[model samples]
Target: MSPLNSTFFINDDIVHPDFFFISGLAGIPHTNYYYIFLGFVYAVTVLGNTFVMFMIYSDHCLHSPKYIVVFNLALSDLCGSTAVIPQVIDTFLFKSHLISFEACLTNMYFVLGFLTMQSFTLTLLSYDRCVAICFPLRYNDLVTHKSILLIIAILWMIAGMAILIAVMFISTLSFCKSTVVNSYFCDHGPIYLMACNDNTPSAVIRWTHPVLILWLPVPFITGTYICIARALLKIAASERLKAMKTCTSHLILVSVFYFPLCFTFALASIIHRNARIINLSLSTVMPPMLNPIIYSLKTEEFTESIKKLYRRTMIHITVRKK
Candidate 1:
């Protein structure tokens, strides 16, 4: 068999077949490590995202446009992580990696859908911060509840349409002889390697997908953030300090999530072999793990809310003991 056509499975698991030979440490086995580490990550991801949803739903203080967008983002993370991580857990625990073709397509759709929505939401957030800082006079008027809702609706619609178009393009191509994916999931990276056709459409997806999802958003966010920073620097020292305190965390997060993501996917078409897969997977996975930590942990309100909930539960338990 051609090297491209040859694939190996992890203990006969029905996995992404292309991942079997990925180099640069991607396909390296962490047999025991992934089980323990991913289990912890899965628990935290599920619980933390759910808690954010709960906080948004329950807290009257979280009803503002900023929090509303955050709530939507939490929901997106919850959905996206859910679609990928459970299969990961099942694979490790049950030794069953046989994902059917239809199931793989469904997982691919949800992942692309939520990841696209996340890009748009992050763009929306940067613009929100820009107007809030650089044009304070119009901030409230520009970012009202109704307006935020409209923007979110548009983002969802756009993301859905984009996923639909891309998946349609992918489905038209045939898997033919090779059907094995090598990654933990049916990530596009692994799928592209196993594909039997000319891969012209896949090449288009590699370029266009990143442009649509990452490149288009990164500039707007980065430029707006820069403008906001410059505008803040011109103000009085105290005001500049306050704005920095409020906005610095988000700027850090935007850089972390967008820059690497944009660079990785933009270059995937050139080097999607196993060696590149490791780096790409790390870049893709880190954003979902870090986003909640950056936004929620930095917010005093969320921290305080969690503390209060803990104390209240403790008190109820104490009383129940009596």
Candidate 2:
């Protein structure tokens, strides 16, 4: 049998449900311009996050809790972006949905896993900030390096297991070609649609997991930040200003990273539709591209760091010229 029409290896008894979005997308003309646009996005995500990572590692001035959290977030952004961009670029360049069943599950596993890690890490950072600003006396005890490392370990472990559960369930699914995916990536939504058997369990995990992954943490993180802000407003003026300024960049970063993600994941089931896949892809990639810029450029310290680096480079060039 041709791969597209072949029977499932697991069970030849069932047929995969036809995903309407993939069906519709298969009819549209393939275009290279979109690939070019996505390439730019991938470049930004990689370079921007890498720059932040470099800044944190090289600058002794940034060796603090806030910058550490920022560094961790940059790491997460880099991992998450890298996990998806390779396959995404391949899809756009080749215009082929011929990803093997194993490859699809692996891609889904990492993409989902890194994204979950990002969300929880952001939440942890928010809590760290809240404790630092609102309970300075206890902040040192609460957000020590040991504590941060331990939490990071937990985040990775939880994300891995959560995604493993989902991917294991998906790996068992049988997709008989009909492999046209609507989005530029092999997201679980589109992959589920290509399956030849009943994908109801996969669908449930795919659609429901995002709630715990993305939404559940938002209110807790942002809410604590808001509470801390309110508490700051009532403190001594100098200390209050210092605390607020310290956390300002963090708060903004939290908002930018989580808000769009919450909105997008809330519409997970809807995203599998042809009418929504383009927008969903835009939403998914745009955050990774924008996250480093929003955090680094908007923060006073990061900008100053950049200016200092630039000035040092200029001085070095002048010395060479002499």
Candidate 3:
């Protein structure tokens, strides 16, 4: 057996057959610590994203197009975290590393799909902000509620179609050899690399899709922000502060979303495999938990709404008790 091929024995008869085995954070000491930490991270991710979505849904003041985009981003975060973290916890804490072929593919689909959705949503949000700041007089005509909804719908459609194409190509491949994935989750690279058949199409899709998703939007968003900054330069100090405040949270989110991803890919060549896996896993969890917190802290409306909701809940509780 090659050094790369790690064998997992099942009973006496089955010896490292073609079964999916997740290799999570190998060579890490004190895995229980990782378990507890990741459990907390997952819990926070779920609760934070859920609360953000609820805030967007319940608060009438937050019915604008920007907040609607935020709500959808929260929804995507919720879904991506739910799809990944539980399986990670199971694999790490419960020693349940074996995943079925069908389940792995399904997980892969949602993970990639939600990630694409988030990228597209962020791009749309940047464009929305650009229009609002650069052409305030025409922003209303350019980005109405109906138009935002249409853009969001198109975003979902495009993301779904991309993933569906990749999934269809993946489905046609054969996994007759080693099915052990050297990562915590069923990532496209790791899983597709395990295929024994021709993976040229899968490789092309996997490589090109991420480039298209990440590279295409990044320059546009950066340029939009640059324009926003230039536009702010001409305004009064107070107005400039207010406009920049509106963008700060989103800029933070973009950093949080992209920085780790970029770093992970850049360091993959030099970092230890175990460290890379650990970094990748944490990257998946950290942004979802942090996004809502950034929004709540930076956005005055979200904070006020949260306070109002708290007050109303307290008053209702007191009345019920009395």
Candidate 4:
């Protein structure tokens, strides 16, 4: 048996396996500690993202085009985390690894779909920053609440359709050879590679999905910043510093979100399964937890809104005491 193939999945003959078994962190000692850690990560992700959404919703000052993208990113983070973490806990910790065919497709859709939206949203943010830095006079006209919302909606549909097609393609595959999915979840690569037949289309998607989600966005963001840099050089030192300051949080976000996945993909074949799983999970959940914190701390507008909300809460409590 090849090192890559799971022993339990090696000799199966069901043309369309009704369910697939999730295999990850099984042979490792103290694996429960890992799942427990995931629980804590999920909690922080939920609270942090929810509060960011709340801040955007309640503050009229935040009702601008930029905040609309911020809200969309927060929503994508929350939904993406919810879709992934609970399933990971249920499958690995609870020993309920049997995922039905329909459920598996559903899982693939939400996990990959929202992840796609996350990349697209970040690209949209880059566009926002590009315009603001390059064309300050036309910022209000080029970027509007309505226009931003429309772009976000369009991106959501594009992501959904792309993932939906991938899911449908998976449905056509004949998993006659393996039912053991050797990953933390029903990850596309592990599942598709196990198929008995020619999974040519799935293989295409396997590469293209990453290109669409990571490669395309990273280069675009890098180019966006290059343009921003050019624009900044044309300005005075003080104004340039202030404009660059607005990009600090986003740069951190792009780093945390993409770098791990890039590292994993680069070393996937050489690394242990457990190591890849941990890397992928972090690349998935860490951004959702850190994004809101980064924004609230680094973005001046969000910081001011947090102060206003805190003051309002204190005043409400005082009035109630009286």
Highest lDDT scorer: 4
TM-score of each: 0.81, 0.83, 0.91, 0.94
lDDT of 4 by residue, 1-322 (tens): 3223323322244356667777765666898998898899889989999999999999999998988999999999999999999999998789887887779889989999999999999899999999999999999999998899899989999999999888887887877556777787778988889877778999999998999888899899999999999999999999999999999988888888888988998899999888898889889989999999999999999999999999999999999999
Give lDDT: candidate 1, residue 218: 82
Task: Give one digit per residue, the lDDT tens place, for model 3 in 186-229.
Answer: 78888777777688999999787768567788888899999999
Q: Give the TM-score of candidate 3.
A: 0.91
Consecutive 10-residue window with the lowest summed lDDT within model 2: 16-25
The candidate that achieves the highest TM-score relative to the unseen native structure: 4
Cα distance off (Å), candidate 1, residue 301: 4.1
TM-score of predicted structure 1: 0.81
> Mind sharing the TM-score for model 2?
0.83
Off by over 4 Å in 4: 1-14
Could you tell me which 10 consecutive residues in candidate 1 have the lowest summed lDDT? Answer: 16-25
Off by over 4 Å in 2: 1-7, 11-31, 175-182, 190-204, 237-241, 267-272
